[model samples]
Target: MDLEFMEAHLPLYIEAAVLTLRIAAAGILLAFLTGLITSIIKYLKIPVLMQIVNAYIELSRNTPLLIQLFFLYFGLPKLGVVLSSESCAIIGLAFLGGSYMSEAFRSGLDNVAEIQTQSGLSLGFTRSQIFRHITLPQAVSTSVPLFCANIIFLIKETSVFSAVALADLMFVAKDLIGIYYKTDEALFMLVSAYLVILLPISVIASFVERKVRYAGFGDTSTVSG
Candidate 1:
């Protein structure tokens, strides 16, 4: 291991780490919004839209993210829809992450008991009112752990953006290996950087999950006739 070389390149690694964080943060945000919107559309069973959303999720989940990034960055340009590498990385990450995130949200929403909806309806509440007042909170509580897990996964997966030449941590490490011939040191630091970034996220997610479990999704007591 070339400790001197590693020390000299520390600034490069730090810059790469910052860029990786920005990309991951932006990608996860996009994924959350996309997943939320798609899950709601699916939940509502909106005609035509539901089919499209399902198809999107199926295609995204089934395919490799590399192929997706290539299609966005390389393939789209053939049709005159040019996108920069960074944009391609963000969109690709969002597409892949959103599919899984949608499933998590849909599962959470499903976990909300039908009885809760029925009780609200019996009280003359509108469908929207029941969802807003009764279903959404419990669903969110149940979903928090899964949502956090997906974010962790997405953060780790941001390493893939390096394949597209996006200058993420992995890309910088790759460059260092090529330039300094210090493969062990470069790879070791790369792994350490990711651990630094992902470990806290995992811990926080577990803590939130435990809190949600103890908090009770909502009152599950049966409604008396």
Candidate 2:
């Protein structure tokens, strides 16, 4: 490994990593909101909207992020909707991540017992009130592991932002490799950059997951007590 070359190129990688993180954070936030709303719609089984959400989930999950980015950055301009590359990247990541997040949230929501909901209903709690006060908290707690996994997955998916001309870490690495032929140095920096970003998140997520599990946050039986 060329330590000198790695040190020289570190700033480029850092800039790219920052861009990547910003894009990932925006995408992840949008995805979480989208997932939460869609999951709630599914849970409530709203007639027309439920079918639409189901189709969106299926389409988003079934397609590759690359294809989605291409459609956003390239195809949309043909239809008179011009989007910047960064916009395309964020939208595509959200489009892809939202489906996965929806599934995670839906799984959590499903684990809440029907009896608990019924008990709330009998106590004169509105449906929205029950969800806000009881269901949402338990479901979110139960789904922490899944949420962490999805966030990591979405961050990694930002690698494809290069396809939309975003100067993400993957783009910088590939550019350096193509221009300077320093494949080893470029790849080493890329890996290290990702490790810096993801390692702490992975460790923290594991710690939080263990804490939630130990606290019995998702145990359906505890609902009665």
Candidate 1 stretches with Cα past 4 Å from truth are 214-225
**Per-prediction CA RMSD (Å):** 2.8, 2.5
Model 2 ranges off by over 4 Å: 122-124, 214-225
Q: Write one digit per residue (lDDT tens) for candidate 1, span 18-75.
A: 9988888899899999999999999999999999999999999999988999889889
Give the Å error, residue 203, model 1: 0.9
For candidate 2, the TM-score is 0.92
Return model 1's CA RMSD, one decimal. 2.8
Best by lDDT: 2
lDDT of residue 225 for candidate 2: 70
Candidate 1 clashing pairs, residues 3+ apart or interchain:
none
